[model samples]
Target: MAGRGGTQGKSGDEVVERGGERDAGGGGMEGWKRKGKRSPDSSLRHVFPTPSAFPLFLHMAGSEYGRTARDVLVACLALWSVTSLVVIAVWRTSPGVRSMERCKAELHRARGRLEEARAEWGRRREELQDLLRKSAQNQTHLRRQADQLTQSLRNSDASVSRCLQGRLTYSISRYLVF
Candidate 1:
């Protein structure tokens, strides 16, 4: 088994071998080997470098930390889903929503009633105007009749005064003659 830490060259073609059991053919490094039947100390050993540390660390951490992280993420997602459902349920049953619906219904009914009242008022106004017009016409007719009656009375009074004056003059002349 190789130790955990190791160094790599800049070109990624070299690796410092760590503490590990060397194979009989002397593999180049833990998971790398030189090609062909080359000596263990040959420079050809550096042709292919060992694997990098970051991929190894990820492989190692995936066993424990990855599971815990996945569990926590799943739990958080579930909690968020449940909380959203609860909020939706509460909002649906809230009194304010119901009150708003009722108020809307009442407002609709009130508007309808107001429209009816306005229509009725319009009809009543038209009827009152018609009555006023008829009353005005009747008043004009009555005034004309009254004027005619007054003229007839004045003519009768003049005729009656003329007849009485003629009778009085005749009686006086007869008494003077006697």
Candidate 2:
């Protein structure tokens, strides 16, 4: 539901991590509770724990291999690092492309939302301008009528001056109203 990087969206159920230890809900030290070494009816007695692997490797290293534990570990790590690099290089072409594709899709979706917001703003601006123009037109008409009544009151003949004054007063009262 969120953006691509923040989506937490995976196309599959596999729990994958980029070299970081993840237990889905815990850590390796706490032991696997859902998969791999952990399963219903499984016991530690039947499982050769990963910690024993180091001792076994050390024994083999000091045996006919003529390697110290340090040398053997370095060799193993070097091999591990190199093999991991090779596998990453190969898989990068696929997963990397998929990740890029997802990013592009999210970008497109954001762009669409941005465009829709801009369009709505432009429409509202036009409507506001229209309303402002109508208000100005009404105000102009009122000002013109007020000026006409003032001019008529000053220039009227003295015979109908009272009538003109009364009519002007009536017109002024009308203009004073909204």
Candidate 3:
């Protein structure tokens, strides 16, 4: 028997409805749990407005409707999980993504090699410059030593010629005296 608004009498048992909640003759949620049976009408209320509205579904009790809803929910969750996995696999294995990653790695390695090559070139250049400077200095030192030696030879030649000339004159005069 239906009561004023939210209260109903079912087989002399009291059922109360308040703000979308139902109290089945006990107290509240605890009383509902103690009964070990959910109010069928409210279980899938959010999905189906009435039992007649369910697609290809016959007039069933609340428990059966709840079971059907649960099965649908499980099936939907499974489908979503499979779709998510497929998308992830495709993203991971796509050639574009893989190629991009490979290109990035190669670029990084190339940059490192380029930097090393530049450093080597700089070091070699400095060494070459230093060697060239030292060679120039050595050349200048050798040229100065050669010039000094040439000047000393010329001076000795002049002194030797004068000494020979004086000796020749003295020997000739002695022969005349004899």
Model 2 steric clash total: 0
Q: Write the per-residue lDDT of candidate 1 for residues 1-178, one digit (tens) a residue.
A: 2333333434554333423433343443334444233222345325435557433433333334544775788799999999999999999889999999999999999999999999999999999999999999999999999999889888888888888888888899899999
TM-score between model 3 and native:
0.51
The all-Cα superposition gives candidate 3 an RMSD in Å to the true structure of 9.3
* Structural similarity to truth (TM-score) of each candidate: 0.57, 0.31, 0.51
Candidate 2: segments with Cα more than 4 A from true spot: 1-102, 149-178
Candidate 3, poorest ten consecutive residues by summed lDDT: 55-64
Candidate 3 local Cα displacement, residue 75, angstroms: 8.5
Candidate 1's error at 91, in angstroms? 1.4
Model 1 misplacement above 4 A: 1-62, 166-178
Task: Give the better candidate number (2 or 3) by lDDT.
Answer: 3
Relative to the true structure, candidate 2 reaches a TM of: 0.31
lDDT of 3 by residue, 1-178 (tens): 2222243345544443433334444543355457664553445445765545742231232234544886888899999999999999999999999999999999999999999999999999999999999999999999999999989888888888888888888899888999
Clashing pairs in 3: none
- In candidate 3, stretches whose alpha carbon ends up further than 4 angstroms from where it belongs are 1-84, 168-178
